[model samples]
Target chain A: MNESDLPSFLLDGEEIPFTPGQTVIQAALTAGHYIPHLCYHPEFVPHGSCKVCTVKANGRPAAACTLPAQAGLAVESDTDELNDLRRTLVQMLFAEGNHFCPSCEKSGNCMLQALGYDLGVMTAGFRHFFPDRPVDASHPDILLDFNRCIFCKLCVRASEEVDGKGVFSLTGRGIMRHLIVSAESGRLADTDIALTDKALEVCPVGVILRKHVGFAVPIGRRRYDERPISAQALDDAPRMMEPKHG
Target chain B: MAEGRIRVATASLAGCFGCHMSLLDIDERLFELLEKIEFDRTPLTDIKHCGPCDIGIIEGGCCNAENVEVLREFRRNCKILVALGACAVTGGLPAQRNHLDLGACLSEVYLTEPGLVNGQIPNDPELPLPLDQVHPLHEVVKVDYFVPGCPPSADAIWKILADLVAGRTPRLGHGQIQYD
Candidate 1:
């Protein structure tokens, strides 16, 4: 059924064509309501762990990632509850991973760090999990420290999708479910991967690492770990490559 | 206190120039240190056969006969030997290939008929022959201090240099110190 031909609903006050089964958040986004997300990539089925993109759908809190677009559905994306959830999620990510923002090469510019500050998550109440992960500095140009993993399966997906190499695989169970090598040994650097693994670029946290470049850029010019308006928005930006006239 | 005119040497073996590039991340700070310390041998400064020095910084992991010789020479000359990066400390990325069979690796990198190379690796006398396995610096000789990280963070390099300049013992001997 043509969405333009169907009855439209006011999503964030934007007249969006009503779909039969989609949720308010999804319909709102199809109507151009942008929400920042980490664990929600358009290409893959979302993990929905990082709740940076949670929006108020008809006054009810819901993950915009998994929510489908539906008719006559209202979305309160700018509400307090959605903002609070986003903040909390960003804070959880920072304390969960081995994110030493001051020293990280990706510091001043990490998506998680930027989102946390954007959501005003300054005073954290969660206990920091200071796990000791053995640094897999085995590859000549890459590194992996599991303690820093945020369970964003970007690397796993990247290895399989773009690289066409199933170098990474998520294993274990529950919170223990994290990325490991695809091979039986589950060793990262020893898994015959390359320096520019898609896993390296897909990482939102400093878990999967690379060699050669650190502290090279001056501290003054590095990406600040605050106010993730641009980075997060770009992730969900409408594909320019798609045919708008189609 | 004189802080003692500290001497330092830098060398690489069985690895790419990534580690060296990391050391250069110190930028002008490295040249700034030259005013205080004495430089003995480094790929950047002195290229001829290396001479004895006080603090020897090995950048890469050991993978050949020459690597062994270099490690020994540094151990013999420098009063304090520092493993300045992950490669030197816990075997970094080079050691990953250690998991592979020697013959397989050799064939893949060199002697394979369908290899990328049009010819076999040259049997030239000057080339430092590749070894069967790559080992960390500590495996070959006793290292006095260790600075971990793919390539030791510039802050780490600065801290160690500052410690030595202040006549205090550089604290890289125990526990892992990763600057992110």
Candidate 2:
């Protein structure tokens, strides 16, 4: 149907004309609602992981990242069920690995840290499993501790897609599964897999880092304090903090 | 043994001196630490490879046959063996080529060229044979305390060591990046 022949209706009791091929969250984003999320960068294809941005659409919790927008659909993007689901997901992430935020350099500025706070993940409901892990700090300018990784796969996808390096890959299985730096050495410096700014920028957490920059910007003026990494739907709006996180 | 001095044996299997360098980064506090730590066999102090100790600190990853032998000896002797640095921690940078065929790496980087090393690989009687893959110390021996940092920051190493001296289990990431 042509633009003139499209259906015009009320979305959340507000008058709006629907656009084609956008998700309910995307339309909501366009309509100025900042739904919280991680693992859903605008440039990449939808992954729908890190269920932090779940929202109730038509009375059921739906992942805002992958759900498609329909004509005049009522999406309860801010319902209690979705909040509960997000809280549960965050709690699970807390239980999975060694995420000790207080000692972490990214304490005040981490996105995962912020989401855990937003979801009220005070304690991990499940038993904590402190897996033995080796951190790769061989690279002159990057450090990696897989123990701190949440398996968001953003670095793996970014390195493969945006940077064309495909340097990072996830390996192993079950609780033993981990992100391997090259073959399985877990050393980033040894591999010919070069680093790019793209992979450095998209890492939701601090698994990857630019050396010599920790605590460089001080506490009060840190990125998380300035913006609080919740749902960023600013529509190509430039986030002005330091972006090297891969 | 006056009271509660933990006997820690420090040894290197197949890595550079960097891991030891990280340990020394603990600095002047070593004097205060000497009151608590009892070192029986260490590369810096003791020359003998064999030792009777409580906690064994093994630097370097196992690469050559000599390294493997040294690691096995330490694993056999010590009550708790701690893998230090990237080398011992996860095979470090040396294992980067485990993904590649040894023949291909040998020919590409060393041989198949007009340099001194040609298509034929080196055949030395003294040199130990290289393994098809590099493996972390944990893959071979059970590790009690896992300190995952390249060469862990001085504070990290200190915290773990201090906790050990205090008879408490050393833990990392108080909940920083942790999530399920």
Candidate 3:
């Protein structure tokens, strides 16, 4: 079939063409439209956990990442109502964790930080939960600051599918839900996972960080600082997912 | 809706006074700002107590008894209250201690450090008692606006002030609104 003949859907009044079986987020991104997301990485299967990518599909709320793109479907993202909801989600994530961006190693490069900026989140809308979580610096090559996890499960999916290590998992339920390593000792060093594992790079927040290279990029010169996340949203997924040895 | 100069007051509760430094970073612009607004009880004026003011710009989170008292007073006295910077907006760095037990934290710092000889938690009557959890200014009192950088860029602070002076709702642009 001709590319022009491909079925298209309306996203915020712009017609976005999609191949068969493509999700709304994928189709929108392919057409250079940005949908704010954290859990729906292109390389990994859509987890639909983070509702940051929520869009109104025919007046009903749905996760764009998981929703299949149907022809003539009216999807409402980029609206004030949706953006405001996204901002609230980002704020809740900030309040739920110890996300002190200034002190975090992932300050500029973090997706959550960039989304917060894109959505114009000025404050943590809810009271800070200030949960007491563990930090695992046992791994020789990586550090896991569990306090910053938003429980997106990108790492969990990446480890299980791509790395074949099953190195990460989520345990508990509701507010009690948290990320855990697969080792009996509950430490990254105890797992067979390596620095090169996709799991190490999939964290959207500062939860997983490579040691000795924290602030290599200066504040103003870092990713999302140079350009707002909206301008670079489509490229960010693959760019971030691609492994860099250095 | 005053006829003349808008009165502005500023206070630093548990902050490092960096936000005030950023405000002063307005530098020569301060002269221009002074034409439209008059200082009420800021450190620049060295006034100890706040009077009824048009704008109260507060820096820092509520980390002690005095901070809460001062924040409530600012809310009571000022028509508009601006939470200025990460400390005032999100309890900033000092709030990193929110996870730790307050007693243990004080003990670890004052009683159990390696190099300390007779370090004791200061108990002077002049010192304000520390609250168990550091709270953002909004948690203590209603805040009208928030300029939420670590210390919002001098330009950001100036823009907010200028907008308020011109009777406009301050809307920070993409690059202007940052948390860190």
Candidate 4:
């Protein structure tokens, strides 16, 4: 079978070729199509919790990251209606957390902040929850600012799968849900997690931060600030090179 | 004084007047803007009250009763109200206090400080009572447009005003639409 014979899906009217097991987002990324997403890192199994990548597939809302692409599936994305939904979700995320972009150390590189800019979120749109979450600086190398967490759970999965350490986990339910360190002392220092753990790098927001190296990159020159997340997504996309049939 | 110049008024409530300073950062372009608009109750004019105006630019969150009163008055007087900065748009830095108990905050600042000998929370009839949470301008009154930045860049403010003066809807592009 030739690469041209691979199953293809319609993404905003463009044909995106996909391997049998590839998700819509993976296929789209492989085809150089950028889909807005969080909590859908290619390195990990798609959690589909963020829902920023919600797109219409066959007239039904689906998380593009988790939805497996099938031939002839018409996906509607980059449309006014879908983008408006994404904008509202991003705004709710902003309001749910105490995201003060101006003062935050992760201002430029933050995915939530970048998504806010990409989605044209002018205001939080909803009344700010202003939850009083404490900053955990118990670890000498890491700083956990709970106020900026968006419940993406990337850190949780990264710690568990990549680092082979279940140092992070979520507790509670719905509005009260929280990320907790796996330690009796309830502190990052008490856990066996090291500074080299992949979990520290997986957080999309400022919740997990490397101490002393913050603000090292100037505001205008940081990852998302240099190029909007849309462009950055394409730049960082994993290529699915044409598979040759033996 | 011009026959058809747009009447423009600005206010700084629970704000650092950084947005006004950014407006002044328009530098020599101020002359060009002045040709098409007249100040009514801005820091530039030092006028105590807002009058009927074509546009009202507010820069700050409503943190107290006086802020709410002033904002309502501005909304009543101006046909178009612009929320000009992060504070006006999203309650900004002042909204940080929303998580803390207001009474505890008052006590911490006044009565419990180490240097204070006999300090008490100032309770005067003239001082406006503070609200529990600082609210964005739109929460209190309808806002026609928003220029969202810490103190939106001078160019951003200029573009909005120029667009308005030219009968165009103000639009801030990607680089101009900054939160910081």
What is residue B5's positional error in candidate 4, in angstroms? Answer: 0.9
DockQ, candidate 1, comes to 0.03
lDDT of 2 by residue, B1-180 (tens): 456777888887766767678788899878777898888678767757757677888877777777788778888888877776656655655665555676787777667666653356767898788876666676666766555444555666677778777878775433222221
Off by over 4 Å in 1: A1-9, A16-32, A220-227, A230-232, A239-246, B1-180
Q: What TM-score, computed on C-alpha atoms, does each candidate reach? A: 0.51, 0.52, 0.95, 0.96
Candidate number with greatest DockQ: 3
Per-model clash counts, in order, read 11, 18, 0, 0
Among all windows of 10 consecutive residues in model 1 chain A, the one with the lowest summed lDDT is A237-246
Name the TM-score of candidate 4: 0.96
Please list all clashing residue pairs in model 4, or write none if there are none. none
Residue B118: error of model 1 in Å? 59
Predictions in order: lDDT: 0.65, 0.66, 0.88, 0.89
From the highest TM-score down, the ranking of the candidates is 4, 3, 2, 1
The sequence of per-residue lDDT tens digits that candidate 2 reaches over residues A1-246 is: 344454433344554343666655555555555677877776677788677778766667778778876665666655566777777777677556666553456655667766765554434444445455667888888887676788778888888888878778888776677888765555788765544558777877778877788888765455654554544335442232212122
The model with the greater TM-score, 2 or 4, is: 4
Poorest lDDT segment (10 consecutive residues) of candidate 3 chain B: B171-180
- lDDT by residue (A1-246, candidate 4, tens digit) is 466889898999999888888889988987899999988887888899989999999999999998988999999999999999999999899888888888888988888888887887778767778889989999998999999998888999999988999999999999999999999999999998888999998899999999999889887778877788898898888875542121
lDDT at residue B48 of model 4 (Cα atoms): 96
Each model's Cα RMSD:
14.5, 12.6, 3.2, 2.2
**Candidate 3, chain B, TM-score (2 decimals):** 0.96
Q: What is the interface RMSD of candidate 3, in Å?
A: 1.0
Residues B32-108 of candidate 4 have per-residue lDDT tens digits of 99999999999999999999999999999999999999999999999999999999988999999999999999999
